[model samples]
Target: MRIKTKGFKKRTSVDEALKILLSHTPLPSIEEIGISRGLNRVLACDILANIDVPPFDRAAMDGYAVRAEDTFGASQTNPIYLKVAGEVKIGEAKEIEVKPNEAIKIATGAPLPKGANAVLMYEYTRELDEEIEVLKPVTPGKNVSFKGEDVKKGEILLKKGRILKPHDIGLLASFGIEKIKVYRRAKVGIISTGDELVNLGEKLSEGKIYESNSYMLASLVKTSNSIPERKGIVKDNKEEIKKAIKEALSNDVIIITGGTSVGKRDLVPEIIAEIGKILVHGISLRPGEPTGFGVIEDKIIFMLPGNPVACFVAFETLIRPMLQKMQGLSLMAYSHYLVAKGILKRKIPSEIGRRDFVRVKFDGKYVEPIRVSGAGILSTLVRADGFVIVPENLEGFEEGEEVEVRLFHNYFPAP
Candidate 1:
């Protein structure tokens, strides 16, 4: 079946579709009780370093801190031994200053003693007469990490919009940063509509399926590091649909799945027309032919296809970006894109004016095409590595044609 949208242009261009999506009201500002240890949450602002890393000059190894000139010509055959004046423990300092032929024993991360310019590892010497023998000659400033060596004060350690990682956390801790400021989470509302859809754990009946799309969409929203509020499922009645949509519009963004495809009972677009402008009734795309974009009282409303794989693909391609934008992130977090060759030969039909994203597997660095079928076949998505973009102007991919594949999940980093 083809798109049934009438008047003011029928076949939607990718650019037009994007422009239409952007035409909707920007997501509203919301207040949320934020949490720490955020993995993929977009940063609210730039993080500047208040303290220099290392804080002070410290020894890098368990060794002796001595004047370099005293052991300048020390060798393995005839070593120089300095009198062990005292010992410095890690995170402690000594009051005594080192003079000629005098050394202070220091452990790893210990502050350097006064008048000491170099450190000699314990492996390079032996102990005799309460003095350590240095086999290797020393140079000035060797084996010592200076204050601000790794990072300087006032340096922008982690930039704004960066999704926090384990390494980022360690870097923050190195600067004595115990807590940080992050942006408030995006508040999203979900509404699932269908008389045939029943709640989970209920007894199954003919022509009835559990309402899994709402839960799946909610999980995806959570995975994107946002808050998902379930608005519950409504029946096929138009008045109830309008009321449910209006209620959800009170949030930052709203997502309505099912009741989107063009059937006698699919009143999603009609109901959207009653409440607000229908920016896009049917996107020129595959699997999600029933997809639509619109607005309801300043909140963005997206009608996604009822099928599982279709909804999943639409969320990755469409809904994910909007949520990131609302969170102040410039790009989609936790997503990667790259180009690879098709391994197996197959042909798939795409809409005349719409682009198609076909799933394929990674054969080494290149992708091998798989038997991608209807959106109802959930296993097709499980077996795929990523999806390829088939341009609307050209025919579908051939056996060995290279294409751009947008990854669905992590495991393959951008090449």
Candidate 2:
């Protein structure tokens, strides 16, 4: 009982393909939250300030909160004098006020005493027993940080879903914020499907490769602030694959790798057909040609290509963005820079009917192809900075012509 898509046509653009995934209620919810200092959590809501930053009028200079008029015409040669009422230390505050022709000593960050409108720097003053001589003119409202200057009460400090970086914490601490609400990370499910795949510790048999795709996928998910629920390796057997997909769908987005391509064990697509609807198969893309999508019990089942590089690239480029969206991040175009030097001049090979992503690396001044052979070479992917997608209308890229590259970046910092 399989509902497989046959005579595959590449109608799926990357964006259109992703939208089809949402036909079911496949997104993770935001209710699951646990606190751990919230160091790196995305904000669940915009934070409005309960208190003003600085809390009161404060001195922005270490000098005197002065009656600016009293310092009028003051000069080094002909200094104007005003009685020094008192000093306002950096931390302490008082109820003192100043009348006309008066001033008070103030340090930087000290709250301004009542009736004082400006500050004069310490370098512009000379002291006397009963008064201080102002050697420089002071203007009204100079060197003062007004109450709520840095931020006002009830102002939106951080928008909902903004990731809390280190500096974000400092702003909260400075404003006396001890806690905040942030969106919990969405949980993701990672499963590897293939009889040829073995555990990492196991010695490689003649045709068996150690299970690295699962670990790689898990790490990628974790880096994006998503929790990865690893369901380990499932053999290519139909029923086994079905059970794995069933369990993974229980978590969040289900990512199944290995049995996606057409092979003896490429039964993952077949199994999903029994349980769900295959949205798209045989994407018109390189390195990840066998990519497919389905919905299983309201969960997304992404059958990523089995090759390690293909799996790695597909997750980072295609899947990570969707996860970012689930965490409340508004989807937007991000720029990925590609720096490379061209070595050869030739036409690129691609049908005008499909888009091809060509892997390239930096050669000092320009990008160069790291893999002239094909997408199966994971090692060459390690050398690439980004990809130049060759469109189907164009047979190939002219070797010497500069090209646009879709760079792959670790958008989330590596854990």
Q: Backbone clashes per model, in order?
A: 1, 10
Provide the lDDT at 343 for model 2.
Answer: 45
Best model per lDDT: 1
Q: In candidate 2, what are the lDDT values of residues 70-93, reduced to their tens digit? A: 788989899988888888898896
Model 2 stretches astray by more than 4 angstroms? 1-11, 23-28, 31-40, 332-346, 406-415
Q: Give each model's whole-structure lDDT.
A: 0.75, 0.74
- Model 1, poorest ten-residue lDDT window? 1-10
Q: Cα RMSD to native, each candidate?
A: 3.5, 3.0
lDDT tens readout by residue for model 1, 134-251: 8988798888888888888998988877777767777776666766667667678999998998888889899988888888889888866778999987999989998898778767
Candidate 1 whole-model C-alpha lDDT, 0 to 1? 0.75
Error of 2 at 115 (Å): 2.0
